[model samples]
Target: MAATGGSGRSTVADLLAAGMAADGASAVVLDTAPRLTSPWPSWTVGQEAEGLAALPPDRPLTRSHVRHAAALRPGADRPDWHVLTDGRDWHSPPLTLPQAPAAWLQLAAIGGWQCVVADTPHPVTHDLLQSRCAGHIGLTRSWCELPYAVPVLCASATAGGVQALQQAVMALHAEGMPLQRTVAVLVAQTDGRLPAVARAGATMLSARIAAVVHIPHDPHIRAHGLRTVTRLRSRTRHAAGLLFHEVLAAAGASWGTPLPDAPRPAPLAVVSHS
Candidate 1:
């Protein structure tokens, strides 16, 4: 997962891992971000940070080493779900961006994990997009970040968002990113129905990407903080599931089964707000 800061990349990564694990797949999350917090709440109290810090800087990382360092998620139905994150000040010099991908690849090899969700740092570069991961999920709170699109999840939906999405999609295509792999996730931040502007924005975004998944805002996520998908609000969980399915399909993951097409929500007509 890649996105500009605060685009909810970590949350999405957590959800994706949970979804995979719930399906009986062995999944792991590698947090390459600078924070000390574990995106997956279940592993927060474990020795995850220490495990990552113990990785030998001089030797090639292996499955055995990773397993030794990874912290397993407690209470998971599947015993294989785990997480790894660097402890603050653990490495004399923290792992650089170039080094992070190699570490992620090494961890992916271990335990024959079915999915490896990497919560990468912000401003995802072209090289990261082309990295040897199963696929990429890009999150953006604004349309301007569309140029970095890779099965993108746009977190906002407004009139301005609609215009920005169009420009972003074109910019992404111009920059050599495949638009077919793009997606827009319009997040409503309140309990009421989606605003007309947001609904219209979703329609415009859908025209340019593989799918547009609307996530109804859930206060529970904010109140309780990040946790397993099973603990999230029903609406939020359903939306995340849809987003996960769309992303996997866009990435051409063999594990993804075909989902039947459902009628999209009616798009509220665009209107001037000013």
Candidate 2:
């Protein structure tokens, strides 16, 4: 997942990981952001940091090294998923651009993980963007960042935000990014009913993008740190499920069959022009 900055890309990555795990897919999140915040803090102990410290700077990372760096959180409703982070506060020995692809390959080789979500920094440098991942999810709080072609999830929380999303879609088309790979996610950041402009923006976005999902603001998600979707409110979980499904589809992933215990969100009503 790539975000310009503070667009809650980490949160989206976490939700996607949880959703995949719930669906019986072994998932792992790779934190490539400069600021080493663990998306799965609920499971990571200090040992994760120690594992990072032990990594050799000179050699290519191996599956064993990745396992060593992997942190697990137990006792969730689903099987435990792993998170691989740099495990340090500062980006001292950062993963160089050349090393990123190798690191991703090593993680893929770790075996049994069906999905790997990466939370990356702004502009998503060319090297990382070209890596062999399923697809990309670009998050932006503002519409100004929507010109690229990769699939995107925009968070519209206000009237201006809505307008920005509409304009961004036009800019995206002008830039040659297919609207079929784009998505606009309506995030109700406030408690009151959604603004009319936001609703209209969602309608317009639905006409252009593959899907549009509305995620009502949930205090539980905001206050609670790093928890499963099961712990979220019904509406929040439902919206997350819809977004997850669309994301996987855009990535060309075979969702296979849903697990019996998996929480599946109802599909959002979309207004498509096509």
Model 1, residue 209: distance off in Å is 1.5
User: In candidate 1, what are the lDDT values of residues 84-104, reduced to their tens digit?
Assistant: 765444334655433434435
Error of 1 at 170 (Å): 3.1
Best by TM-score: 1
**Each candidate's TM vs. the true structure?**
0.69, 0.66
Candidate 1: segments with Cα more than 4 A from true spot: 1-3, 36-43, 74-80, 88-103, 124-150, 157-167, 227-230, 253-274
Sliding window of 10 residues with minimal summed lDDT for model 2:
140-149
Candidate 2 vs. truth: CA RMSD? Answer: 12.0
Model 1: which ten-residue window has the lowest total lDDT? 140-149
Judged by whole-model lDDT over C-alpha atoms, candidate 1 comes out at: 0.56
Clashing pairs in 2: none
Per-residue lDDT of 114 in model 1: 58
Cα RMSDs, all models:
13.7, 12.0
